[model samples]
Target chain A: MLKSINVPRHDRVPSLIPDTQASMTRQEIANNNWEEALTFVALQRDRSAYAELFSYFAPRLKAFGMKMFGNEQQALEMVQDTMLNVWKKAALFDASRGCASTWIFTIARNVRFDMLRKKQSRKDDVSADDLWLNGEYPEQEADTDASQWDTQLLMEKLAPHFASLPPAQREVMERVYLQEKSHQEVSDELAIPLGTVKSRIRLALDRLREALDGARN
Target chain B: MAHAIKFHPGMSLLEQHAEGSLSADVALAVAAHIDLCPHCQQLSRDITADLACQLTQQPVKTNTTDWQHMLNDIMAQPQLSKQAAATQAQLSAQAAEPIIVNQREFVVPRALQRLAANHGKWLHLGGIATAKLPAGNDYHVSLLYISKDTEVPQHTHLGLEMTLVLAGKIVDENGEYKAGDLLINSPDDTHTPRTMADEDCLCLSVLSAPLKFKKGLTRLLNPLQQFFY
Candidate 1:
């Protein structure tokens, strides 16, 4: 029924990491500022530190891509591009609002969303705020939005800018967009336990809401 | 900000910007999203910061692109006339072209680069290359390349080995894994693996020790030294 290798030890995250929960735990994340991390890494050119972050993130991004597109090539490409962007824009990581993982995922989410939009023949510039708020509504219903007086101002009011988001959270957003797929499909595609996907999506959405409200007020 | 909500695309735009991979216009769209949704906006900033931190660590030595070689290649291009261009277009019309391998980044992502930098050199087998990495004193990290149509001998093992199919597909006791399939092996498991006839198999694997042969002739070669590469 299944192929098996010898009884060697194995792990989910590479054995290199100590205290894996430091990333999982929100308090730990609070202590670990992504902006500060990026700045420190940038100043030192510390390869090991970079490798640690990559080890933690790349596989998840790969997993996300695989689930989103169901194509290995595209998945690898997505992770590659995501990492490359991280390299080019390390100077931009800000620790004040969120953690590192959330930021990276948003990037993956945005990339896949664009792929879907190209096929959908939609106009440019969808905001995260709109996606969260407006995505719940059927397309035609949101058409006559009351705040349509000044389209530009409405857009500004509706959309908030994001630089990067972690892979897990991004996967949640991508599930609904490009795949034109359901949340369950997203879980199946990523091979993650379905509940994990739901939780992450809610978590990501909550963070997005907070960010928007903060930006507004 | 159009007729449809188009929620996830906004997310995708964020991903593109975070990765620094989006075309200019697509980026503008996500920027607008961030302008409205701070939740994603904040998340985007954090992840971007993390990625940036990781990038800052990459040694700058390689940042010096091989421009000279690139320019030389460009200069060395065989300039074909406009007539050749027409001929090329005609050839494309006649036959289906092959898919291209797209690897734009010079260094593989940090997550994957560890597969190389931290692990051992690639060991080349018959068209199929294999490498064993030192995960620990007992554990091993392996990279396997099974060439098209090649049949691996049925073998059992004393330890557990887990394989994550990275590229291509191979069939054995288990089902087919195109990519992103995590196949875990326990002790006493055995099987003969054959690569999909068309493409070679590339697998990133973790193993504990040398495999113990269960079936036949492939066991004989265990003692004799094979190609180092």
Candidate 2:
């Protein structure tokens, strides 16, 4: 009989084993040293550190891209562009504001939106083309210390919060929050009244806020 | 402010903005509003962080070949020089200076500042003056300046119309819209916008289609709608 190894939910301690050690799986290494690895790439231009980040995030980004764009080629391009941005903008990442996952996810999200907008512009002659012309604004100062936002702890809390939502509410939450679909689009897709979609999203957000606030307190 | 902005673009619109799904014009309007409103900014940050968390929880599948390719592309890209970055920042900073309209100098919203040079000659129509902004590709973009106590003719939108109050206040059947308030109107909605007697109203109006005049002598302005564009 095999005993399951239980990982601690909010451990900040670094694993004693080196990330490159043969005994450690790729996922284990990534989970253990992502922040350190990202910092190394940022400060030292370490190729190996970048390789670690690329290996872990590129695939995840590709999957996210595919989900957003529904095209394998575009998804691959999105991953490539996003990874390139990470490499270039690594120095700008402030741990105090957000975690590396949040930073990278934002880059992927923005890149996907850019691709979609470009496609839309080519197909239509709409007048609002100059709207997103400016690059992203500077990052705002963090309201609190980074330690207050333990990435692993938040992630652990979030999964259960999301899982606890009713299926109807969760569907709207996922579509709007994760899939980035508009309320009108989601309403049309589900063939439900717009008010129903809005209420479900509101309820889902309220529950998420309650759970996250509870954790904070 | 007589009335607080009773109307907002809804959470879904803000969420789309945070998710980077809104169109550039709408996004610009939203970004300008976010710059002035801290409440919306906090909401935006929360939504972004939540989305990031959701992304992390999803199962990821990718081949080794994809990772290798991504690494290659990242390696091939040249790193931006610190000096170059500093110069770029300086350029943007210089470009953000306020523009003078009539005698009043109003700081352009960062989103609109980039297109400041493209503003056309100020054209006066009754008590309302308009300047066409060359930036919007899909919508008719203009800066409408309404003098104190002036009233715009009652009109309905032929399509979607978005008005973002950049300065002062405008009142309609809905409510009073102050600086940073975004008022969106569709074909079904019709209203006459009037400026308060205390101050002149300045607004950035983006129209997907022309406005249809609904009352009185203004109905004749329908054929002259091209002038508004």
Candidate 3:
């Protein structure tokens, strides 16, 4: 169940890659154009496009699941379930609402939640209504290019922003967001007040907002 | 943006909704609110993307055998025809229309439409009316209607009570709750909810347990609290 990848802990050593190498890698990924790949799967059921998406996202999703669940087998299951949903619900992808990454990420998040709930023996009776609301989709048409560009730019900035977060804020944010733990749970784990836990999360989010807005401007 | 709801669900609730940790009933209420609130919608999107970006950076151990099996499963599934797709879209669009009770019409939030068909019989209680909605797991849900200028007896919840105002205004000690406002009250809260004189108020209330009436005369209704449940 655990196929260990022998990669170095590059997240801890952010400067291992030279600036030029990092930028080139970012450029290459941006050039792959996730939206077009999703469109291919949606319209043509293209195997190669699906394969491309699977190769890119499945591994990352597994990593994300492991971080959240701390179990390799469950993480693999999460990756499998998320990819299955992507294949089954490809046509539901709406570029007008968001980019491919945003859509897929939302799916992965929801899938993880479902798995957690099922593990706790909770009933799953939420109708489709609990998923999306309102007839008016967020109209990104006016600034589609700008927003898409911002999304890509933000993705590139994520690591640096995370690395720069204050230690307390970073720990809370990681526990709350990445590990899928509630603020109350984090407070208990860290032996801090719940209010402190919330404040730390808020401060981290504010820093990210400021940094991302700076990038946009 | 004039007359926008002053009170919204906490950011943590929205975050939970985005993360999928919220119960289905609470999530449905939040989804309905998100449809009505742009600020929340944007926040939810931002959080989702941010989480995704962080996850994308993690180095993953790829299991080739599992990947091959998944690919095979995906390939074997049948695809929907264009006609079927169009029809499904049409049906969902039609489902978005407003729900009518007597002469009053309220635009059902897109997320609540699927549950619209299961709305129970409307039971009149003094100036207010309620109809139980389908139970989702542990919670009992109901659509509550308060006539203009009507006041509900002071009450506190037996367990957690989440009320999402769907239309008009409900005033309590906390604040004026208008459409799209979600008020979460635990056992510690006690308040008398009165509607403004201008228009009738509609709200969806999800309760973890039955509400306990705390005031005079209404306390007699406590024995009949099972009725509300």
Best prediction by lDDT: 3
- Ranking the candidates on lDDT from highest down gives 3, 2, 1
* lDDT per residue (tens digit) for residues A57-149 in model 1: 566676667666898677666666665545444444554434455556655665565554554454422322222211111212221222243
Give me the displacement of residue B39 in model 1, in angstroms: 21
Write the number of the candidate with greater DockQ, choosing between 2 and 3. Answer: 3
What candidate 3 gets wrong by more than 4 Å, as runs, is: A1-27, A30-32, A65-78, A88-96, A110-124, A133-136, A140-217, B62-65, B78-93
DockQ of each: 0.02, 0.15, 0.17
What DockQ class does candidate 1 belong to?
incorrect
Task: Write the residue-wise lDDT of candidate 2 on B120-222 in tens digits.
Answer: 8888777887887754467777788888889988989988888888888899887788887888888899999999888888888888898889887999978
Candidate 2 chain A, run of 10 with poorest lDDT: A1-10
Where in model 1 is the C-alpha error above 4 Å? A1-92, A95-97, A100-217, B1-110, B114-127, B133-136, B224-229
Candidate 1 lDDT score at position A85 = 46
Ranking by DockQ: 3, 2, 1
lDDT of 3 by residue, B73-183 (tens): 655555444455445544644655565664688876777765765688888877788887764777888888888889987888889888888988899987788888888
TM-score of chain B of 2: 0.87
TM-score, predicted candidate 3 vs. hidden true structure: 0.71
Of models 1 and 2, which has the larger lDDT? 2
The collision pairs in model 2 are: A126-B138, A127-B137, A127-B138, A127-B139, A128-B138, A128-B139, A131-B24
